[model samples]
Target: MTTRRFFIKTTSLASAALFVKPGALHFKDAHIGLQLYTVRNAMGKDPAGTLAKVASIGYNSVEGATYTGTENFYGLDAKSFAALLKQNGLIMPSSHYRLGEDQENGKDLMGTILHDWDKAVDDAKTAGIKYMVCAWLSPAERGNADHYKLLAERLNKAGETCAKAGIQLCYHNHDFEFTQDNGQLPYDILLSHADKNLVKFELDLYWVNKAGHDPVALFNANPGRFPLWHVKDMDNTPQHAFTEVGNGVIDFKTIFKGADKAGLKYFFVEQDITPGDPFISITKSIDYIKKNLI
Candidate 1:
């Protein structure tokens, strides 16, 4: 993933705009954020500038993808980063982390097994992040439900420690979790086994749709469990193809209708690839969400 490409997908959208009644939309105190992974290059090249662009687009918060291989994020430690965010009229509330394992291959990747649970807690505390998430699980860990159960237990432990620091631990999902095993989805197992108070969910809209399911249905089934959401759009042609937020088939208005039931606190815009300029797509998506869903 090149730096700019990492900012998001290559999918394209027509330059059209919608005019929604402001008062008709349900606006929450929780402001929309961006997943920095979408603009990894921008962040790498100029963290401050990238963050400034994000805030300029009207997003008030962000979820970090990485910590720049240092305890600091983009050369700024927790305190400095917080100051930068405040200066830019933004907030850094959460981050996605490689949890429990260094690599998905089950090998001791990243030169370690991520053995420093205490250090991990301390680092996140220093960063002032309220949530530390195990971003994704590899196929190797998806061998069966038992593995998920074990992972859930481990996540609970991590979440418990985070709780002591006044932070929440969460899990982000891709399409794989919805894969059926013994007629049951692994997501169900993870959700059922994990401690609710300690751990929560960050639902990715594109992945949920790719899994041949309804995001709203999941929200309805387990109200108040999903506190975060990755708001991305799917191309009208197929599952994997990406598109700008409102240009695709995802009915975000309908999803937002369930926001209260879903216990949504933060929503972030993300794209793995783009058909055109990432800036255009990002700005368009933000406009769509602000105009329609809020």
Candidate 2:
């Protein structure tokens, strides 16, 4: 009896070789990738199967999250995982990682820096990922500007390590990064002080808007520093609900036009919460991007 993994491996090769007739499909001038976290339900069930579904949805790449679990990315290890992605016409360009944990306790905080993320960086290299990012800053770490300065120093160290490995260290933002400390935004401070060669940024459009800022303006201010982005949408309603792409208030066309200047190399569609089926939500997002942004 053929095992599930064997069956998947065979089918993946066949899928990669499938042909596209003339004018059958078109990709964006800028490629569009998916963040697997968008379909967390599917991923939690079968990671390889979930990857297959993403490929079926026309995604040529993916961004990973929570890499510590899920049979170490379908039990293939880093090199095998990279091979699997290549077999599926997919590339994993980046991954989200939690910031360092406290040494005194196991919880993540600003109190300590990650001494062992070098191992993770090595694994990322094997998986063909170019960017290692801190996905979120803990509340304690975000408590003040000095805290952010400290975080920036730690990130600089990580970024330097990644630079030596031919990779980049990036910081992903949420709405709180816009919170002011002594009339200065912590995120701005981070951008200003962090080593430019070592540190890059992954701008989340939705959270930037939620923080009452403009994505295009940010791109204009810092040209070519951002190489990754989180593409999510928000409802036009008074409550500003999370909704499917193209059904929300964000103006992606304007943003997509400025991608080159923004230093955007890859972008992933993400939604923190879905009002309905996540699969449907992701499908709609893919369709919207292909139709409008592509």
Candidate 3:
């Protein structure tokens, strides 16, 4: 009767033992991006309008979250999506796509489940996306260290596939990967076992902090492994709920100082749950990032 929440709590306790001192702050001008998932509702309603608003908010880059079974970018074909981004003055460098494990109940019958994978990669290339990320892991896909090992193998294969198409493959982590399984963290297994040349990571800052792990320590342990990041913040509440970037307690300034060490290439602002209008929330977050962190 062990629930995912219980497992997360236990893992938090386990990760608390490993903490490092905050490093010095270093600032650099980097292209600000947004994960389209934050405004998914709006995007679903009007992809063009949503992206236009996002661009008007000063986000020069974006990471897509609407590539599931459609193999299309927000209902638009690859070429059309690319054109739309150009019209909005935005560039898409990366996107989130569910892995094979989380799709079709982990089945691979005649490759129908992932039949659109090649086309997806091709479309991403056409759309100028440099990274194709495995966005999440199903509860069933994560059982133990062995399961993670198998998942890592799948990641490597996926990475190889993307590599052939001139794109990099990355895994996006949630709090679950930070938890331990038989004293071995799934994150460690994926980082240590996954092929470094083919597989990278897109670190979500808020989830890593919630898991009681230090992002700096992770960067120190595995240098140049993280090329992308989800720039979200956490409030001061006991739950550490999502908040606007500068409004939260997370020390993003110190974290960004280690961007070089983390091998950061692009970062996207993503507030999973906002209080009011998502556009206003993102605007405030981006303004804060420009003024303070980035």
The number of the candidate with the highest TM-score is 3
**lDDT digits (tens) for residues 90-120 of candidate 2:** 8888988777543225633331237466677
Candidate 2 residues lying further than 4 Å off, grouped into runs, are 1-30, 68-71, 74-76, 102-113
Model 3, CA-based lDDT: 0.82
What lDDT score goes with residue 289 in model 3?
Answer: 75
TM-score of each: 0.85, 0.85, 0.87
Q: In model 2, which residue pairs have backbone atoms overlapping below 3 Å?
A: none
After best superposition, candidate 3 residue 116: deviation in angstroms? Answer: 3.3
- TM-score of candidate 1 to 2 decimals: 0.85
Question: How do the residues 139-208 of candidate 3 rate in per-residue lDDT, one tens digit apiece?
Answer: 8667899988988888898788899989999999999998988899999999988999899999999999
User: Which has the higher lDDT value, candidate number 1 or candidate number 3?
Assistant: 3
* C-alpha root-mean-square deviation, candidate 3: 11.2
Best by lDDT: 3
Candidate 1: where is the Cα deviation over 4 Å?
Answer: 1-30, 102-114
